[model samples]
Target: MTDLTELGVAAIRDGVAAGSFTAVEVATAFNANVAAAQAALNAFIVATPDKALDAAAKTDKARAANKPLGKLGGVPIGMKDLFATAGTQTTAASHILEGFIPPYESTVSQKLWDAGAGMLGKLNLDQFAMGSSNETSYFGNVVSPWRRNDGGNASLAPGGSSGGSSSAVSARLCPAATGTDTGGSIRQPAAFTGISGIKPTYGRCSRWGIVAFASSLDQAGPMARDVRDCAIMLEAMAGFDAKDSTSLDMAVPAWEAGLSPDMRGKKVGIPREYRMDGMDADVAKSWDDGIAWLKDAGAEVVDINLPHTRYALPAYYIIAPAEASSNLARYDGVRYGLRDLPEGAGLQDMYAATRAAGFGAEVKRRILIGTYVLSAGFYDAYYTQAQKVRALIARDFEQAFQQCDVILAPTAPSAAFALGDKTADPLSMYLNDVFAVPASLAGLPAMSVPAGLNREGLPLGLQIIGRPFDEQGVLNAGLAIESRAGFTAKPERWW
Candidate 1:
């Protein structure tokens, strides 16, 4: 039998349903792996092996009783810390949120539970999901399992916000994990860790319980080892939610059953704007390889222009932070999270002290930027202008999609950089999302598939952006890349 930890979500689902292996065994194996790697990887913010085993036991009992299992029955997964788990701590990797546990489960996590997925633990992420690198996590930076081909022992970052989710799935600590994408949070990290992840079109998944970053752009999705696994998990995670007004009111599409590697008649758009100055040679080559793979799968490649591409990053920074300032205002010490009340301090003094003490540097920076843009005089000049540019960016995609079914581009400008390398320069760090933010601003469905390795043996990912409600087309394209890329490279386990 193959390693239980190494199996994909679909395989695990089928195996548990067939009684070929008990769910308890699967949970136990992954629990041991998580325990062993916790120190080196720093992927999980908290370990919930007991919860996992309890869920697994229920799955095995269901099998014994000849009852139907849910879509994720007996499968274990990591919950991103941003999601509010009923009993577990749901910190968004920030001191402000530390020790805050929700009495209610997030809609997406609850759906996974109802579908039979076991909770392994809450995974780490950047504070308020702000940083490109995982270094800003309050717990500590998550170390990627991959090393450079030159055999340098330096630790690399698992691209952030969803860094821990990517690290755990790639290291085989869990079959799949939940991730929220506000601006490349899911896709960028998945690319860095050599896995598959998709950010469904905005409103496809409920935002009811996930911590808010940008109300308009945040979306929940699946991160898994392969496209099929991501498809299966996504079906269970997405659907209409009355609790969230943003959630679509339609039934979730059956993406798993409809998975196909055929792209014979599909038109894949190669955006001319993604070829930026100083793009890494390896990244360029991988994008070229992705084009060839899609062509081999029979997709007709067409060059399309998105004229507003340059404005996406600037617009996103402004809009996301503006929303962040509003959403995060509730964290003032008067409520549940950490409060810094000085002796005999007044309400205003306490609020200021708590925020100053609780928030990290990066989170503070974003909040300040957000507040400034939304300020009285500057609001029209900065925030309003950015919103207008955002509309233009969406229009650019709308126009481009007329000539093509989906767009293909590199997931990031370069491979995973060494930890601490980009921490000093905030601008450089923000550039990591250059290729990913455009689709995000447009509220489009996008996915990242591991394409191939760079010259120094780092993995490179190719992104596919699809039109609204076209996740099936996006997954189909990803499957085509997965079949051709044959990207089975794994980080050598030094831990």
Candidate 2:
């Protein structure tokens, strides 16, 4: 018998339905693995073993009774802490919401439940999903399982925002997890941890009940060990929801069933602007290899220019923070989450005290930047200009897609760096999302597939960006890379 934790979403579903193993047995094994790693990995903010077991039992019963099982039947997964789960603490890795449990479940989580997926637990993440290294998490940093090959033994960062999701799936705590991408939270972490994650076109997954970061940019997707598993989990996680105004009314496509690695007659665009100055040699080599792999799969590789690419990072910083400033304003002491009322202090004083005590340093920094950019004198200069640049970036993609079906690029500029390497310099930290933000701004689907190992033995990922509503194209491209690259590497389980 194989180790149950090694099986991903699709394998577990088929295995459970075929009676090869009970869903409970799979859940129990993963639950133990999660428990064993919790102290070292800190991947999960809260562990709900009972919830997993309970859901598995139901799945097993459904199978025994010959009833129809949902798409995610018998699959247990990690929930990024940003999504509101009933009876579970849904902190965005912020002290402000440390114990805030939503009475209602988020639309995405409910969809997963309806599709028979069980909750493993809420995952740890950057405080308010603000940082690139997961260091800003109130629960503490999510240490990547990968260490450098040089025998340094320095604990590496599992990329931020979705760091815990990346770490857990990479560590085999769960087969898959949910992650929200606002400026590369999903793709960058997947690159760092040697896993697969996809951020579908904007509005593909509902934003309702998920903790707001940047309203327009925050889109949820799946993180898993392979492209097919991501496709399967994504099928279950995405759908139109009336609760969210931005929700796509379009029907959810059968991404898993539609999974095809064949890229015959497909055109893969290589953005000339992606070749950065001072790029890591290993990362550059990986990009080269990805191009060769797509070619091997019969994709025509052509260089395309996205002239606005240079402005993407700056525009993202402005737009995302501006929206975040408005979205996070609800966390005042007057309502839910945290309250720190001073003795005999008025509302204004209490608001100041509570916010000061509640938010983390990075969260505060972003809020201030957000507030400043959206200020009276600077709104047109920063926010409005950024919005215009965003439109230009989208136009660039639209024009590029005319010549190519999908675009290939490096997921991040470099491999997993030592934790805290860029914490002192905010600009360096923000640069981590340089490759990923352009796609997020265009509201396009992008995926990160493990490409190969860097010289230091850390995994590097290749990204596939597709036209809007073409996740299938991105997944197929990812599969082409996944097969040709033969990226079977997982982090050595030091934790």
Candidate 3:
């Protein structure tokens, strides 16, 4: 029997097309892997084997009928918890939304299904997509299948919000998974897990049914083992949606078909702002290696400055939470999900009690901060100022793009840390996103490619950021890094 779980999106598509194996066989293999790894990785909140088998059956029927296979035909993938999957529970790793299953599907997931992808299940994530580490998940923090090289057995985090997606993809529990990047959720996790992930330019993927984290920053992308797989999945996930006012009304480019190792005449930018105080030596070295790889691939290396980078993290916290406060307001106990109503309590009392009991600590903290910043008295002083700073940050990217085609930097300051290492200090946890947040604030396309492993054998990622709606350029640059880095390390099957 073939180890169908080891095949990537492109390989699976070709195999299925060639009748090397039935789609049902592929789905069965992955479903069993997901079931076995659930306890150890905590990757999936729920497993939907029936859905996978059903989709795979359809693919088999189409092949039997001599119909053209869909772009992702017969490939099974994991859906992140934030994306509503009609009948399956779509909790964003929060207790408040526990047992809540949307009647509608997220645009991205629906598109993936239309392209013939099967769903293994809804993956876990940080509650409300609020945390930088996976520790904020209500179900439990996801443990990376990876371990230190020198003999320590401490369980490390797979990075936040999209941590489950990263863990599953990295562990080979699934070939690829859908991930949402709101302030680095997708990239950070991908980096930590030694996988490739991309956050398409804002609005590239419709946000209609995906749980809103930061309305502007939350973007759906693919997390996979390599750049080619990410490209294949991303092409199937991105398109315009009339329901989403912010959806980009543009043609979805065939990114996978355009994948080329040739980087002749491309200028890769190394931002001076990314060199921070107290930076990890390993991360710095990995970044230097990435630059060398790009140069070797025939791309010109240039130095660029994004002066407003320092203000990005602060501005992001403000803007994202403000938008989150507004979007999450609909989740009050009155409509759907958990509702804690004290006996004889009035409407206001019920609302207060429900929220207090239902929301996680991190969600509440962000809500409180958001409400305070958007308060009548403080709005101008904080919210308005933050918006101005956000514009400045965007302008900084605009100016820098003139100097180079794409900017390269470390995805995170360091490699994945042990669970609970930074949870106590919220500020410290927030800083993990410092390197990935600026591109998000500017609504540009950014991707993370596993460059190398740290001394401790933990994965480190190099980020590539491109101009708006230029995911093709970003993916091309990533291919250069992917080709040169040749990162093929996988976590030992400790799980």
lDDT of 3 by residue, 162-248 (tens): 999999999888899999999999999999999999999999999999989889788999999999999999999999899999999
Over the stretch 384-486, how does candidate 2's per-residue lDDT look in tens digits? 9999999999999999999999999999999988987999999999999999999999999999999999889999999999999999999999999999998
lDDT of each: 0.95, 0.94, 0.92
Instruction: Give the best candidate by lDDT.
Output: 1
- What's the lDDT of the predicted structure labeled candidate 2? 0.94
| Model 3: how far residue 384 lies from native, Å | 0.8
- Could you give the C-alpha RMSD of every candidate to the true structure, in order shown? 0.7, 0.7, 0.8
Worst 10 contiguous positions by lDDT, candidate 3: 1-10
* lDDT against true structure, model 1: 0.95
lDDT of 1 by residue, 104-134 (tens): 9999999999999999999999998988889
Provide backbone clash counts, one per model: 0, 0, 0
Q: After superposition, how far is residue 215 of candidate 2 from its true place, in Å?
A: 0.6
Ordering by lDDT: 1, 2, 3
